[model samples]
Target: MERTLKLTVAYDGTEFHGFQRQANALTIQQVLEERLAKIFGHPVKVAGAGRTDAGVHAYGQVVSLRTTGSIPTDRIALAARSVLPDAIVVTAAEEVDAAFHARFSAKSKIYYYRLDTGPVPDPFLRNYAWHLADEPDAAAMHAAAQRAVGEHDFSAFRAAGGAPVNPVRTILAASCRRDGPLAEFSFWGTGFLYHMVRNLVGTLVDVGLGRINEEDFAAILASRDRNKAGITAPPQGLYLKQVLY
Candidate 1:
């Protein structure tokens, strides 16, 4: 019997080109499909909850696929372990209803961006966090982040290419805080545009750095022009933290 299986995945993302497959690139989806094909004895395709950018990590990325393989859902992760690379892991797996689709069934997604604000960068965190010698004001960034809550047109924060047709999205929650040498930004939303979170973080960093104030941040968001926003934070600092069903 064919079954729809849901898998919770985690990956370092340091070596992955991205979560989506590309014609000439090594991607998470391509790697997963190849390894899963070996287990299923047929070609496999994966649907990911989020198409995270290159070098963006994940803690609880969700994916779902239909398979006729005899392997039980409980053993899927273990089976995957033997075939998958060290950077990617199937943390959990379970059978789901046939109608469940990873991307369409998701109600919300949470993303986190981390920054190392210490004068000296930590060798271990170099691949996991963005190192900044000049620390921004976390409190100011937190204040600016609050303006993002609720539904709005997010065109200002989107990247040039591969943007969604609809520019409006609802941000459920947002926050920024500092923990000693590390600073973290959290965003929970119904959906996000390409490079939205990273662009927002970059603008917030501007506010924190005194280049822009909270009101300026608000105006930039209202402007809805990508040129008005700040830089796109590097991919290594961002992580797809969770996907809500």
Candidate 2:
């Protein structure tokens, strides 16, 4: 009998192209599927809750797969971990309802972006955080972030080259805070566009740097033009923090 398994996964993503499988490219999904297929002695199709961009880490990524193997669901994570690279780990696994899907069933997602606002970059954080030469105004960034909350067209923050689709999304929370040399941006949303959070952070950083005021930020958002927004922040600073069911 085929059983559906849900997995809570975490990965460094430093060496991955992204979460999706690509032709002749290394990816988290590719690695996971390869290892899982080896374990089951058959091809396996793994689906993820989100396709995190290259260099973006994840702490609570969810994945689902159907398999005919007789391995105990509770021990599947352990068996998978024995073969997966150190960078990727299956933290938990369980049999889920047949109708449950990792991506389509998700109700919301949370992402966090980290910035090191220190003059001297920390070597320890080189692979995990974006480094800025100087600290930006946290208060200003936080205030600007509020503009992103609530439902709106997010074309200004969406990256190019994506398939045409509705640009509107609902943000439940958006905030920025600073702790010593670390600056963090947190976003909770029903859904996000391509590179939306990164672009939003980039624009908010501009506000923090005094390049744009709150009113200007609001206007840019209302304009729905990508050119009005700032550059896309580096993917290293981004993390898929959670996926709510």
Candidate 3:
């Protein structure tokens, strides 16, 4: 009988081109699938909760695998971890109903963007967070963040390169909080577009720098134009924190 396994994974994505495979480059998906297929002695396909952009990190990324192998679910995580590449690790795995899916079944997603606003960023965290030189005003950013607390059309935050579809999306909770030199923007939403969180961060940073009035932030959202928003924040500063199913 075919077996399915749900996996909780974490990875330092510096080495991955992204979560998806590529014909001309390395990626997390191809690396994981190749290692898994070899270890399980069978072909394996993964259903990830979402596609994380290149250079992005994940602390609690979820994925499900279907295979003909008969390994016990409890042992699957450990076994897979041993075979996965250096940057990727399977934190946990469990048997799931064959009908369950990692992507379509997700109800919400949480993303965290971290910025080091100190004089200098830690060398170790240099690749993990953005080093903002001007120092973001956490108060200004946090206050402006609340404007996105309710549902609104997020076309102003969508990437320009994406498919020409309606950019309407609802964001449940959007807030920015800080701990000393570390500023964090946490977003919980029903869904997000290609570069929604990053663009939001960019706009918040603009608010922090006094380049944009906090009160005018809502007007930007109402504009429904990508050019009306700030630049897309770097992927390194973002982490895919969770997928609520």
Candidate 4:
């Protein structure tokens, strides 16, 4: 009988193209499937909670596997470690209900964007955070981020090409803080459309730099126009922090 196995995944998106499978490029999903298929002795379908964008990383991504074998789920981490690449790791595994759907059952997600405002970007963190010599005002970014709270039409921050069914989303928390030379922005929301978090970060960066006022940020959400927001920030700086079921 096929039982549902839940696996928590973490990966460095610097090398792979993205979470979703691509035509020729490597992806987190493809890699995980290949390895899990080998272990299961059959190709297994791995469903992820969120398919993060290109260059985007994840620390608490959740994926599910349907397998017939009766391998102990607690030891799945060790079994997967042998085949998984250096970039991706399976942190935890367990048997969840068969009805649990990784993507559809998700209640909320948390995303983090890291920025390095140091004078010299550390080689260690260069691939992890966005490097910028000029520092942004933390207070300003924090203040502007608060404007996105509650339910609002996030069309201004979505990707231009996506045909979203709904633009309304509820943001539970949004804030930016500085730790030494690192500026980290975090957002917890019910759901996000394509490029929404990155675009929101870009606009918040502009606010931190005093380029956009609080009124303008509010206006962008009210306008529900993509052109009103700033550029889509690079993906390397963003991470799927967690997915709440």
Off by over 4 Å in 3: none
TM-score of every candidate: 0.97, 0.97, 0.96, 0.97
Q: State each model's C-alpha RMSD to the native.
A: 1.1, 1.1, 1.2, 1.1
* Pairs of colliding residues, candidate 3: none
* Model 2 misplacement above 4 A: none
- Please provide the root mean square deviation of candidate 1 (C-alpha atoms, Å): 1.1
Residue 113's lDDT within candidate 4 is: 96
- Best model number under lDDT: 1
lDDT of 3 by residue, 1-245 (tens): 78777888889888788898878888888888889887678877888897998899998889888888877778877888788876898888888889889998899999999998888777877878888878888889989999987788889999988887767777888778887778999999988888899999999899988899787788898898888899999999999998898
- Pairwise lDDT winner, candidates 1 and 3: 1
Greater TM-score among 1 and 3 belongs to: 1
Tens digits of per-residue lDDT for model 1, 41-73? 788889999999889999999999889989878
Model 2 vs. true fold: TM? 0.97
The true-versus-predicted C-alpha distance at residue 161 of model 2, in Å, is: 3.4
Candidate 3: TM-score?
A: 0.96
Give each model's clash number: 0, 0, 0, 0
